[model samples]
Target: MYAFVSVSHPDEIKDRKRQGKLRQHAIRNGIQRSKADRAKKDGVFVPVEMEGKTTVATKRPTNTVALTKAPSVSLMDPFDTLCGCPERLRSLMRHPSAKQAGEPIFCVEDSGKPFFQGMETIFRGALTDPSLFHALSLVLSLAANNNLPNVEILQHRGEILNGIRVNIKGLKGAPQVSTLTAMLLLIGYEYRIDGADCNTISMHIQGVQTMMKLCKERNVALIDEVQRALFWQDLLSCLMAGTPRFLSHRDFSDFKNPIGIDQSQQWQVPKGLEESMMHWPPECAIVLEDLNALCWIVDSECNPDQEVLETFPIDNTQANLESRLMDLLRECRNNPAEPDPWYEACILAAYICTYKLSTGIWMGCYIPEICIGQIFQVIAKIPVDAQYKPAPALLQWVLFVCGGMTERKNIRQQVATLIRERYPDPTQDPEQEWETLRTTLKSFIWCERTMEKRIFIFWNEVYPELHTVDSSRNKMLVV
Candidate 1:
């Protein structure tokens, strides 16, 4: 049944290229010194001032071949070559027609996770550069079929690395943008190839970071797509790495509101949500804030721009939030006394929210299912009839999201029954009933990346016929 419906984001991941000349010259692609002219150290960066602006310059290799006019860095460098793969193999990487989401070639199960939307084609080859073509092939193959032999995977990986190394071996400035994409693709490949067996993606991630640094410090501009890909990889990998995020200091996630959130007047919570949860920790609050912003961005249905990246750089925003939750979950379990059911439930709810918008291979492959299963055990500790004194709104959000994420039919029915028990459709204001539910969802976190049809199934059951006229819009099921 393809349990979770995979969605490609509404916006296409277009090439982001900005051309500007370095202070010394007025070229559209910016200030790039010819390799032969780069007389300083081969890999060391030296500051160079031009037109009153200071930019870094790299020392070049001893033997350099200088072109009469340096070519501009294009994300799609179609003429680039050096991938030694035979034509038979190269043919496999080429798709004659564009495949829609959920097709055999467009597999994105855990790859899309909760909210990693609009990224279906990132691993698909840019088809411009040969090295990148190989990298994309490996990632595409692994994503399409996780059970491919390790030996085959390693051979393809080696070829990708060798091709990239040779292509950028003597470049004076940053590696070509397609090479940057390939590097990002390799990180994605390693992550998929090795679940938690090892952390091979770490070195690959650091390598791309180095390439990005070369571009920025030297006034070399990379395509916007590559930078965005870097942030996404940083976000997913950090959860398992347990190390501080690679893009730690580069966060810009703080925007109270951006655009496209249609709700105006929020419905009054049936209970005092804020007053009751005075005991909640600061970390919980931060995660909720991050989730709320995510809800807005997802609801906006727009491509994630600089504002969204800065505000919700998963590397820091989600990684730190998950780390804090881990600590809290551990402390709660290790306490000398019985854990606070309310506190435990709250964090578990927030923990579930972590996957509501994004899902990926964390410490455990497909950890979303495992973590959501544990949620029931915690909820069991609380009596069914008893109200969560901390906040009922929080509980409802948890039940609905947890219900959508759970694949088990009986468990989902149990969740739907629980939600109905609290807010029955017997109310005189049935329209208001549905409105109130969406209001609460928005107040916390909700996005289409969430299991849409599943959530709507629960909603239709809980409050029959309350679905809006446009409810069928954006149906997520693939089969």
Candidate 2:
């Protein structure tokens, strides 16, 4: 769960246009960084020259090594020791990645990469805790199947649900870390499978909330890991339900508003936001500043120490961002600014960030449909003509975010076409397009490390005929 922070040197910030590079995830060592640096300078992607597993090679993990928990693991090791990752998940998350074939575009399969924060600790408890093992096993099964509940998943889920019903009656509150982990696991599993609004999911969330309240009554403090995970889930659930977050008494007092370094100050506006922001509702702009600040925290402060985390929790920052946007939308619902694509695009980007970054469930979970629908609406309303046209740079960012949000091939192809409509130069190679667009997106709220591979994929998909000759070669060229 360590963040992939990609901070740029301060002295070079201006000359670099405050652009940050996500150190490549596939090659989690310094060698990849050097290659990526060279690629950036030359405006190209250079694949690692490896013998067995090429940097860009990706496939299903049918006959691969079993990803069981190791005795010890490196932070960059994509596999966790306690909770073994299934090969199927590892395949989908492979950096030279494509989702498992036939998988839906924006499904739970697209949750962040394999390794996550506090995962090791949680699984360590599973070693001796039957309940935690069952809960965690069910979650891994759900994720492995892309949240589709299979026979085994159903049986396991039933056991956990029924057991909780009976055991919860005699509880002395959120009694143990293992107990809390199992509960959180079940809450995450139900939400991804049945959605946040489902009565079952709500039941889990409320039960956790009640337990936390009871623990506070007895003055038993939760460690940071469990506290952070619970806080993140509750905030996301609140956003989905269109209700204010139920930050429990303990979490509420412990967590404060965002306190990270403010990189959005005098933020260099990208061409996209630059052209259209003047007309945006004032409130939206305020939220955007906060949005950039959150993006910076998530993107650059990857490995914050405990004290740093205590002061500037990423979860609180995201919760605040979502709340502000929802508030602004409420105020504007009466007489919405007549379909300003730029206006809606900014908001859409913010929602995507909040969901994609902070949804503590690393594998499977539902992103609320509220923002998903708005993505299409904004796309359809995009003005094609030059008169009163917003910058394509904005569209590029919006469409890329929207593409990441959807699993439908049609939607993705449509995104490439529209993006091409603005850039309309079949003569341009993806390397150049990515380089140009990459710089433009940095000015907006984006995480390059998380998105660079997707950007390359979209660019290639949109212009496969750009003299690359061989399609497979084109995709691999960027490896």
Candidate 3:
């Protein structure tokens, strides 16, 4: 009778109702309280409700630290703090001895708006990322201390390499843009540190190629102006180093026109005269691409078969490209009384590349004296201040071509002095290389034979390592 009369207590009913409400609230919010919450509720410490906020309090009257909500955390990047002050960045970029130093072959214009924008983005990201910042700082310090003795230079170089290693290791998990930019900075750093040696630089470029492939797979488009500039820089680096291009044909397929050529097919110089040489005709890119491809073919360990050879028109292709380049050069030369030194230098570089491709020698059928003289004339007319504004690689290559071809002792000495004064790096030798090249040129001059034929004979007899073609093959004359 007692069991039958038993009924649920009012407090138990209220407790059940509150439990159901909590379940419903958790379901609605898609958040379930963990076992820890239950354990906390069961402990001596009880949660006190004040207004709508719940704060925990201990039953034991022991002294306890009051807990208040922490201030909201700021997620702003540290680099952003420095972004508003560009003067600091400009100071960092400007060479300390820019005024005292004679016109450098290349000088970065820190005050330029475009440079500021580009650097702002780079510096912001670098500052936000510790590894990147370290690597960049080390490289900048190395540049600043370039005049230091070999021992100190080597120490900084090792630090930079360590920083690069750390950054590269972190790249595996980094965001796409971050990885790409970091790799670019590393590539630039290597170029500066080691000059044109492709040994290390190619590794960074290969990494970029892998990243680009990943971006492609993810359907990420990298067609912005900054990316385009980076792409061009990578392309030019590969061309100069004689390495295979990182960007495949498909990489550029998205471009309506690959080289930005219009319907007219006329060469368009950039609007700013200062940038004309910096921005070569899109055609130059195409030609450089072809040249790079040819270099790969020539340097490959496995020789291509007739079918593979036919796939790319490497034979006599250089002559055709060189002809087109010469035509463009003539057009530029005819435009005005004062020729653009940068443009002229670029055209001359194209000529040198094509000539070297067609015939395995620095000088082609073109008269060395005439070509050398023209380069010097154009260089003399260029304003000293403006002369330093062009890219060092372009100017260095121009000087290299001129130095390699010049038969005059005085002119050769002048080019050597220029190289020593402007770029003292041994790897970027217009001096040491000139010594070897001068002997070769003199041998050809004495034999009254073109380098095309004489190079094969010289290599077959004296230097087999420098030979690219078979000594028995007469087909090398196709160019």
Q: Which number leads on lDDT? A: 2
> Candidate 2 lDDT, tens digit per residue, 1-479?
23454547656645443342333433356776787788676544433344476555454323435578554433323444333334433443442222221111111235433333544544343434555545655766675676688997787777676656656766755566666667877766654554445555566767777776666667764445566667666644444443344554234543345445464467443444655767777666666766665666655665533322344456556556665665555444335546555665567666776555544333212353446555676567666674666556666677777665444577677767776775766555555755676687776777543455555566667766653532453343111
Q: Is candidate 1 or candidate 3 better by lDDT?
A: 1
Each prediction's RMSD over C-alphas, in Å, is: 25.4, 26.6, 23.6
lDDT of 1 by residue, 177-243 (tens): 7677767767655544335333467677788888887777766543444555676566545433332
lDDT of 3: 0.46
Q: Sorted by TM-score, highest first, which candidate order results?
A: 2, 1, 3
Candidate 1 CA-lDDT value: 0.53
Tell me how many clashing residue pairs each candidate has: 12, 7, 0
TM-score each candidate. Answer: 0.48, 0.55, 0.35
Q: Once superposed on the true structure, which residue ranges of model 1 sit more than 4 Å away at CA? A: 1-130, 147-150, 168-172, 197-199, 240-243, 249-277, 286-396, 405-454, 459-479
The true-versus-predicted C-alpha distance at residue 224 of model 1, in Å, is 4.5
Worst 10 residues of 1 by lDDT: 97-106
lDDT for each residue of candidate 3 in 131-247, tens digit (9 for 90 to 100): 344333334444565523255435534654565566566655434454465456556545444345776777767666665666666666442433543554454444334344454
TM-score of 3: 0.35
Better of 1 and 2 by TM-score: 2
